[model samples]
Target: SLPAAAIHRGAPGPSVPESPGAAAAAGSLFRPLSAEDGEQRPAEIESLCMNCFRNGVTRLLLTRIPFFKEIIVSSFACDSCSWSNTEIQSAGRIQEQGVRYTLAITSRQDMNREVVKTDCATARIPELDFEIPAFTQKGVLTTIEGIIDRAVAGLEQDQPIRRVTDEEVASKIDEFIGKLKQLKEVHSPFTFIIDDPSGNSFVENPHAPQKDDALVVTHYRRTPQQAAMLGLEVMGSCCSVVSPLHVLQFNTNCPECNAPANTNMKLVQIPHFKEVIIMATNCDSCGHRTNEVKSGGAIEPQGTRITLQITDPSDMTRDILKSETCSVEIPELEFELGMGALGGKFTTLEGLLKDIRDLVERNPFTLGDSSTPGKTEKLQEFIGKLNEIIEGKTKAHFIMDDPAGNSYLQNVYAPEEDPELKVERYERTFEQNEDLGLNDMKTEGYESEGASGR
Candidate 1:
């Protein structure tokens, strides 16, 4: 197979026949023709077909200006293929917005998978016209080189991976489309493979999950320059081994049998981890092969690895000790998990420790048989004495109004010095009228003196 372009209709192709060592690739074109031949056209021209020959009726003219270095046509056929006996208009350049592009019409398709047609005048974009004689003489190799040279000029580049999702694949396709669309002004035709079967198909372990098995790959057409960059892989029966290109550090050990068990022990990192295994088996007795596998997990002696290690004990001073506060520390306990009604065994270890600490701190007082359990006789005697003192202090400040009116009335007329004599007389009077009681021992003559402040 020249390429999938030979099988898929409308796929873009580039053929270069002019360059050194490229002439051998000339026959790769779809159907070669010359201007001297009689005008001829394919018998089955489908809907959009136009004449491949016009003046003398010869080869189909695909492109002009000789930019495409290679050309290969598909044997694949579809209803869209067509031919017209009438000669088509000459292809020309078109300017849209500010961009310029060479326009050509062919029953052929461009690299972007857009069909080249002339019947639909309403189409916003123009088409390139073609004639047979112009195409065959230019040579495909020269055309391909020219197309590549111009397309890659000043273009940006990126690396992309294609995954299993439809959206991912569509995005990659769209990128190529955009590049081609931008180059429409260059006017030269170019070809690239899209959806090539062998190029696009991926293989992976079938037992792996579908999503995990998915992989992204990069591919390119074989070129001498690319062949030099091919990667090499070495493998054992069970696994593939790869070596690193650079080393971070190295260690010195016994040249042969680099094992810790050996008297002379040193650790080193080779550019590749796999090299360590080989170093380990450097000197082995043929009769007994030491199948020890060197692990890649060995640390490299660099930065933190090379720091001084403290081995000797240092004298401690009181100043070095941290100031501390009293705190309780408990030992962590492990117990065999017991089966329970619930799915898993559970215990409130933290809560239980807290309750135990509370119990120890409380130290509740214990009672003796000499006192009543609820009410202690000694406590009652202490409380009664305290209550009696409080009541006596509360009654000391009280005052009472006189119940005998005559004594109060006579006191107003009597001199302050005669207060004792007046009280003595009031007592005698009250005694004489014991049957009348203190209320009847009143005096009417003292009213005027009491009112006049006498």
Candidate 2:
């Protein structure tokens, strides 16, 4: 199918329409289009109607949404059968990150907020366990209530025929239709979410001038399958297997200055732990150095959580392998280091603490002049306590949670269990698996499945 776009009618008009290979390479949706831009009107073209086999008209408008992206809104109408349809598509590029929008609906007014759902986006009502799968419906520019109304209309459209063909099926559909209608009543609260791997879907914020406490937006890395679906990856590409050499060195370009640089990769196996790949990049022009560690094995069957009580200063000397997927938390201080915050690192507990302190102190959000004095003062207090913890003056608990079960902390007593350390393995949650893209990953019989498809 062609890339998705916004349809002007059947709901609320869409202000933005972006799609895979169709989203604007560089533009902000918030920018307003000036009158001088001179937008073009829709062009009418005679076309055949598939439903009636009669002459129909398709009006297509190719225009940009303000200063945003270019979109094509098309509407087809056939006077003979009184049939009409509408959809929108974009001519821009796919976004680098996937986006998800979650809104809490509490009142009738909330349903009126505008929404843009690309053909590749998935819409869901978590409370009702109802989902509109991707590609099931064409891209739409509608409000929350508009979506429900359209769904109700579609179900009723086939009821008359179903009742004559299969009475039982019609009755079941009628019952489901009733439940769908009740969703718009707003009797209680419910969450409506749109997940678009293409990064083109949008949900308007009701409180535009102010932050909407009821709405949350999340951006995440796309899975390889999603990239393939967007035609970002070439089919039947080369395998990822690398050379067997223990260490490999190559030249590269510096990210900062685009100057000459060198990178080194080495395979290292930690004692009592699995193997890992360590990469170090150095730029002579900029005098910049970076080191990263990556887990070199398949995901384990279960997640692992490790907790260690920090009592003496020597505890900070312990070696720790913190993978990119591992999250660190200091419960007593209420400090947390989210996964991927520090990338992957192989360092001592003291070194990890120093890195955390540096990240906190150097954070742009907290260091700018726009920051509040109260917040800065509180941060200073937290840093003082962190220093005490590092010096063994404060007793605290250090916890590492890894969904991949790849992170590790050294045990001073070789075969004996450390009194201060506790390890627990548990099954990962469905949401966690979704974030990791494991739910849609197919690795076992994929080759055979692809062959069958062929």
Model number with the top lDDT: 2
lDDT of 2 by residue, 1-454 (tens): 1112323332222233355232233233222223343442345789999899999888765544521144567789888998888876754456646789889999977887777788888999988788888887887767899888877898898899999999999999999899889888888889999999887777765332124578877666877788887778744775765454757888876543345688899888888888888889888755768888888888888999999999989999999999888989887887767565577999999999998887666542343232358657777788888999999999999999999898999888767889999999999999778766788887799899999999
For model 1, residues 373-401, the per-residue Cα lDDT tens digits are 44334333433432332233211111111
**lDDT of each structure?**
0.24, 0.74
Q: Candidate 1 at residue 293, lDDT?
A: 21
TM-scores, each model vs. reference: 0.14, 0.54
Taking all chains together, the TM-score of candidate 1 against the true structure is 0.14
Model 1 whole-model lDDT (C-alpha atoms): 0.24
Residue pairs that clash (backbone atoms under 3 angstroms), model 2: 4-89, 5-88, 5-89, 6-88, 21-92, 22-92, 23-92, 23-93
Q: Model 2 clash tally?
A: 8
Off by over 4 Å in 1: 1-34, 39-76, 79-176, 185-454
Candidate 2 stretches with Cα past 4 Å from truth are 1-219, 223-245, 447-454
How far residue 226's Cα lies from its native spot in candidate 1, in Å, is 7.6
lDDT of 2 at 333: 82
